[model samples]
Target: MLSTAGRHIISGEHGLFRDQVRKFLAKEALPHLDRWEADGIVDRSFWLACGGAGLLCPSVPEALGGPGLDFSFNAIVAEELAYIGCNAGITLQSDIVCGYIEAFGSEAMQQAWLPSMLSGETITAIAMTEPGTGSDLKAMGTTVRREGDDYVISGAKTYITNGQNADIVIVVAATASEQGRKGLSLILVEATRPGFARGRNLDKIGQHAADTSELFFDEVRVPVSNRLGEEGKGFPCLMAQLPQERLSIAISAQASAQRAFDEALAFTKGRRTFGQPVFDFQNSRFVLAGLASRLQVGWAHLDWAIARHVAGELTAAEASAAKLFHTELLWECCDKALQLHGGAGYMNEYPIARLWRDARVTRIYGGTSEIMLEIIGRSL
Candidate 1:
């Protein structure tokens, strides 16, 4: 009844871990949703609490302040957060950004950053997607050039999640613009740097509690030690890491869609119209039936993708396909669920309204559906 009933490929440890996360969110996070949404960000206290509960950076090795757990724990975190419609800012830090540092950073670099991240003493953001660049890394205008023992970075990054509160930002910049993507480099910039500035805590249509923003690096300088990997390997690193990122997105997409479905099913079964339950109506029945069918199939596919990812067999194209299918499915499920709510769905009071709004960006961010198709089509 919760959706994905048969689809969880969990061992005993994972099941216990999932329960712990579920309980933690319910007690520490869910109750404060309204206030956080109004403030446009979750409180830092909650992040600290999450870290205390062993919820952050589960996959990062213990030597680097992580629990050294598998990726399944990360997926569990992503799934549980989306299931409750909690803004996914935490998952972004743990699943996507942490993976980059863990996979590519030097030992000294990892030791410097990963501990604070694991403790939730620090917040992190990845600065890609500049104002004009969209998803094209080659067109990015951000530049990082060597100056003595430091690298000077100058550019703007927009649509950055966790931007308003990020203590550390992994910046994608061009070290040599003439080489196209070959010139790209990922620079680590502390938010307290002299020229690093955040533009605004962006007001968005939904997921208001998630702090998305614009960041500026106006000749920000950091030691050469701040670079994540090789000076010019940023694009390749991004490409390599994107499969996990996309899979993380797919997990949230599938979970949210299922949540929306559950909400609609409950509403249609209980709400009455014309002296009959809404579920008794033929149109409502058909709508729900179709959604249920799709959700079942979606869960199975999600499980398969998760399994492949666990085995290190999941390819970039497969992750793209998962992302494309699940995000589109999320949008559809939210839309139909909202429609079934009649008038209340449009009101902010209804969960469906926020779910609908939150689902919009899943298709846009993490590479748009068109970009996903392009990636997949190239392999055919």
Candidate 2:
């Protein structure tokens, strides 16, 4: 097991905080996993429980109704949750969405939204990927047309996390259609608006406990004050936030890889073949040895990235590299771990099944491996 006692990046306070999170999950999340997976969404009561535990929006300022903690606290929440195979979207709330609001939201916008978000009474999602636009932000078709002091939104977003449960959505729309990427703006839209609608809760191969959906805006109108940051500056805003967002995914991916390795080790030792433990077989031991070596190196690099991020020294390209490495490591570890389980691994009754399923998407989201390479290649 990876020991926390000597990790320089994690101080005593972070260790204690992790313990509290683990205990909370044991009591509040573990027992409900099966039900949540079946329902395709976690209950709102769980979100309230997280808020009461001070687990949401750890980095938001006290003035904005948050704990005023740093990014390390957010990392603790992500690591603990992912280690246990929980896929709740709490990190999206704390790590990604809160930062955008804190950075660019106006006084009125902050006052109106941050407190409820901190309390978990409000769920937020950022709509970036449009119907045919994959990683190309310049190609999105969503539009925010200004008319008589109201901005009307019209477009659709798919594969959105927190979509089915989002109380408010930060929509990325083209304010000046001819300008391409420069025309995009981030506009906050309430879910209660007349033309706002959520399509079906998407059925996915994994991460069933977290709701992903299709979101539509048919001429949904909001006041001019709803714009976040400067008009036509949304692309840069997203670019600035991508580093930390990618780092968060790396944190979760690293912890999850460790969990997969642990599960495989335990299973191989327990399951016997030819009157001997599977772990005793030469091929099994070799596979595990390779995974173990990679995991040790992965954890070290992850800590370095985390420390760099906490110091505000991690660049977009570096964060992209970390995300690429760790997520790919997660896939390899999960795949090997499941192979060690033989036929039982394919059955949903085993924990490795879910871990394997969840690991597949890590390489695809938070920017794909190909996109990460492009970003890094440009830096080179």
Candidate 3:
């Protein structure tokens, strides 16, 4: 348990939730990751299992057909998923994508989707990145134009998480292209709709079990009711919710860093070199000591971020900073842990190698480290 303010950050109810998630992952996730990695996607059965375990969209209120939990519960699920390197899209679904619907969807729309989403029967993807744009929302080229009572959407999205299996997509497109960012709006695109298509499951360097793909919309049409919030107000909603999304990235990075450090410590203590255990060597001891110090500070930072987020007081800059610091730290920890493994680390058979690969994307996705720095710099 992470200690903060003279007590563990996780309380009684939270502890029970954590235990449930830990046991679920142990039985259903950790064992199958190897096959999932090889396949570049997780099975829908596992996603259904996660839903059955109450591990999706946890923060949605009971009135909205959720468990009425807060964001900390969401954080615990992310943390436990990251701990075992489960690369499926649960965190993305539960933490980032679901908020769009809960916060902006109309009562009818929420009723239509939230229940199935919480049940894991429906998977979601958010289409924001395009072939030509990333990080800059203003650069999006997808357009959704109103035609009488319907929206005609035409554009393409790439690098979309959950692309292959999404039952619904929250599409960010320009409803009024001349207004720049103000022109942007989010619309719900169901997978079975006409002219909606999934393109390549883009080959990524890591997080293979989480399907990332290119999506195409050729004059796709949906009722105006499918629009989230009001016309021309989507960017604000995105801005409001993105802090939590970045914090989710930070959560995953923090947990993965700890996992790598733990794995390296165990590996070094057991493996022999020069007639002694690697942990007995001065160099190994120093490296582990340095990582130990960083992990202590990381846990503190993460706890602070989670508290602020759950209280709805975490700022965009703070969330960006958390993302920037922890992801870079994750890369450093993974690299160092791999180095400690010497030859074994370079091999795919070791978890550190996969951890290092996966860490690379943390800095790239959820706003790149450079983007996070820019977001933070504006506050100065």
Candidate 4:
């Protein structure tokens, strides 16, 4: 049954990859997720294990010590991870941050980072959403001033995924004197560098196992060679890369929705109310039927988006649409699923509670639903 669902959602090499990733997650990740959530961060050993499993940065080319798989393979991993309810931050690290480096980094930078990243010896994070600026990349306060082959960076980034555990961070900062989008640039900052300090591992409402942090850079100097793409080209780089990031979030949302639906279905069937199982109630059946229909649509849309992404045809608006729709649907699914679970859903001991908590941020991060609609509306 799992294989059939896997085949429907993915294909060929990606299907095989999904199977391997699923097996790895079941064996290595699932059991530890609750413990990791309690600890507020996953152990670095798991990253190394995933690297050894060849599950990190599958889209990266073999020259960089990756599997060289396509975006479909990446989607496969995302789907499987979400299916197992693993931390979303880990997926963000292995899939999204690595893509930025692979796409924008120079040959020397790639060679230096890719091997370690692929080996799980190095973890990466993208520091963009600042304490003051959330999605407004142009209004970023982080400044990286040029000083003889090095850029002195001073700023603070909040809500950074993998922030505490990240060995490499791709920082977006303002280099141009002018405001709005043009002045921004992306720089690769090593975590070990002087003046690079990580603040507290933030307490969050959800996804506790995934490390979200606040990072501070005070006079942090990085060589000019660490600049990604070109100086003052960071805005374009960020725009170009956003489709994938949004798509990754959408994929996870879809999988999460499906998981919540499945759990709800099982719960409604097994749970007893008044005098009969909850599934016996017309309201429960109708709610689940509607959610199932939405899930089907969500899956179809996501699959189409994944195909476009694999062909390099996915547009920012389209990706945003997927992110917005699927994530919103995921919230509905979680809410209704929790509702169906009665009071049990509100308790942490139940999986639905965790699912409920985790689903809230889907709408907020990776560009809020409002931001997504604005992007799509502008395109139209």
- Over 4 Å off in model 4, which ranges? 1-9
Q: Write the per-residue lDDT of candidate 2 for residues 1-380, one digit (tens) a residue.
A: 33465578888889888889989999999899999999999998899899989999898888777788889999989998898888889999899988899998898999998888888899999899887998999987999889999999999999999999999999998999789999999999999998999999999999999999999999999998999999999999999899999999999999999999999999999999999999999999999999999998998898899889889999999999999999999999999999999999999999999999999999998899999999999999
Which runs in model 2 stand beyond 4 Å of their true positions?
A: 1-3
TM-score of 4: 0.97
Ordering by TM-score: 2, 1, 3, 4
lDDT digits (tens) for residues 162-236 of candidate 1: 999899999999999999899999988999999999999998988899999999999999999888889899998
Residue range with the least summed lDDT across 10 consecutive positions in model 3? 1-10
Model 3, 142-220: lDDT tens digits are: 9988889999999999999999999999999999998989999999999999999999888988888889999999999
TM-score list, all predictions = 0.98, 0.98, 0.97, 0.97
Clashes of each: 0, 0, 0, 0
Question: In candidate 4, which residue pairs get closer than 3 Å at backbone N, Cα or C atoms, i.e. clash?
Answer: none
User: What TM-score does model 2 achieve against the real structure?
Assistant: 0.98
> Which of the predicted structures, 1 or 4, would earn the higher TM-score when compared with the native?
1
